[model samples]
Target: MGELRLMKGNEALAEAAIRAGVDAYFGYPITPQSEVIEYLMAEKPEERTGMVVLQAESELAAINMVYGAAGAGKKVMTSSSSPGVSLKQEGLSYIAGAELPCVYANVVRGGPGLGTIQPSQADYFQSVKGGGHGDYKQIVLAPASVQEMADFVKLGFELAFQYRIAVLILSDGVIGQMMEKVELFEQMPRMSDDEIAEKYPWAVTGKKKGAERTIITSLDLDSRKMEEHNHHLQRKYAEIIDKEVRYELIQCDDAEYIIVAYGSSARIAQKTIQLAREKGIKVGLLRLITLFPFPNVQIQELCKRGIKGWLAVEMSAGQMVEDVMLAVNGNGKVAHYGRYGGIVHTPEEVLQALEEKIIGE
Candidate 1:
């Protein structure tokens, strides 16, 4: 069994990174998630596991470090909060365009600008839909608890290298700062140079005599070639949506109404489910795990099962609710309730919104 400890989500994630065999971490300090690098530095993973942890001057510099290391076939990651993440979008897009394998975490706070240090899910659109330019989507893992904050790190890196893509652990301030029991995974040995060269033939290792020299670039001036590359990315995304969709259903087997949420919002909605059920409201919850490979199929299945209404709870104005509506496709009543710009809603508020928006309506 792995060691169990009560740890904050960000620290748990850091521990998981070292254990998951990440070769490098490059990140700038940002609130709610600054602990990730702090823990990494304090624990001295460099001494323990030979993991390189560096705090870059800015988010742009940090992400470029990840890109450079990942291009050389090293397992790498970074973490930042919302505004810092926004600064890294260009680098993220470049990484995605190059089809490099890496992972990053956005311990989300508020935003449009520097909104608040408190939690918010307003980054949902940017994350699931592709925060940077171009038609690309990161495999987003929304962790609902401290346990998942640790677990998704392993899963994120796995998915990243598996698909040759960047993966996102889309967390929030609450999950990042909140302390809870977490099971730390066993330490994994970092892949040897031979192993990386063998596994990632596309990686930029030293060109061997008569060996194919790897060329990594997102820019293709040739129109048709760029189109082909775009098609390849689209196909990759389609495969991910098909094969990697993940979610959770709570009290949904026989429920007539569904409350859709993810991450910290889903945690609160769990409590809302209990309250609704106690009041004889037969409410259930659909918690999204992979927000990009959104459980469209599952939502459709629930709709077919005659789920009467859908209430979407989030820390956004109404971003994820649109997806819920599209998934429901006029089969049920759909409404959204949220406190955006860094305000976190409570279980009671979620229940009341469900009553008025879904039930009372």
Candidate 2:
């Protein structure tokens, strides 16, 4: 309820997950994100809340464990960094296809290969546009600070269960390792077993003596049934897009330029915005909290409001800028700025881009 103590981003995320009544955690130890599993291990919630925590064989096994537990209608979660997360994509696709509820924390590190153990928001498309195959969308929560790491875990789980979907807490290594103050609630309210079963009756638990055996699976022998299932998932995604668009508008009242960013990149953009204001530049930031929904409507509205240029500042090479362009609808100039392979851009760098792209122009 009140500010409690300083905690690392990964540690806070684990604590918040425990408080959120997560039933099971299955994950392998990966750099940066390993602290999340270590926190759970050290805290040992089983003594208090009867939670299940398993250090799995690999990220592959961990994601499958999430699939199994989520199929049972229990709140479940797992965590990994970039390469580790990439390993779990097949399982993630299965979870998405099955339309199960789970939380996956991706403490993003360098990419394209086993690049480095530093922060990078390079997985923007992977998190938002479906890391795995098939037409699907995950509820991606982009957390900017250590406190956000704690907060988004609970919100992610709630949204996942509510929408019958997977949710991703997309953070980065710097955000993961940093120590910051966070107020963790005493406990989070949880739905009862009866309530869960009542709400998600399709979950596979063995049937009674006379009842039919409930099957929970993404597989359909018939192509038409599979098509129907895909249609249902698409409808759910459409509803999420309509209802779950979330982003922050900073000083856009009469802004001449809009800086679009999210996750840790958004924090850097905030500093850039402050500097821009001090320099008498009428720039604003639209920090997206929900990456999947993409907040296209906000960007579109800003473009309509005479924002001459939009800067897509990210930690990677222009992944989200594609969406920004789509949202701008060719009405204004959209430019991309970033440093990839685990290099996070500084506020000065972002401001420089803004200056060169907007002011100089």
Choose the strongest candidate by TM-score: 1
Q: Could you tell me which residue pairs clash in candidate 2? A: none
Q: Please state every model's RMSD to the true fold in angstroms.
A: 0.7, 1.3
**lDDT digits (tens) for residues 1-361 of candidate 1:** 8899999999999999999999999999989899999999999998998999999999999999999999999999999999999999999999999999999999999887999999999998999888899999889999999999999999999999999999999999999999999999899899999998888899998899997789988999998999999999999999999999999999999899999999999999999999989999999999999999898888999898999999999999999999898889899999999998889998999999999999997
Clashing pairs counted in every model: 0, 0
Q: lDDT tens string, model 2, 1-361?
A: 6659899999999998889889899999989899999999999888757778999999999999999989988999999999999999999999989888999899999888898998898888889888899888999998888888998988898799899889999999988999999988677655567776777887875566887788877788899999998899899999999999999998989799999998888989999999999999899989899998788887877777889999999999889999999999999988999898879899999999999976787
Give the residue spans of candidate 2 off by over 4 A. 189-195
After superposing all C-alphas onto the true structure, candidate 1 shows an RMSD in angstroms of 0.7
Question: lDDT winner among the candidates?
Answer: 1
lDDT (C-alpha, whole model) for all candidates: 0.94, 0.89
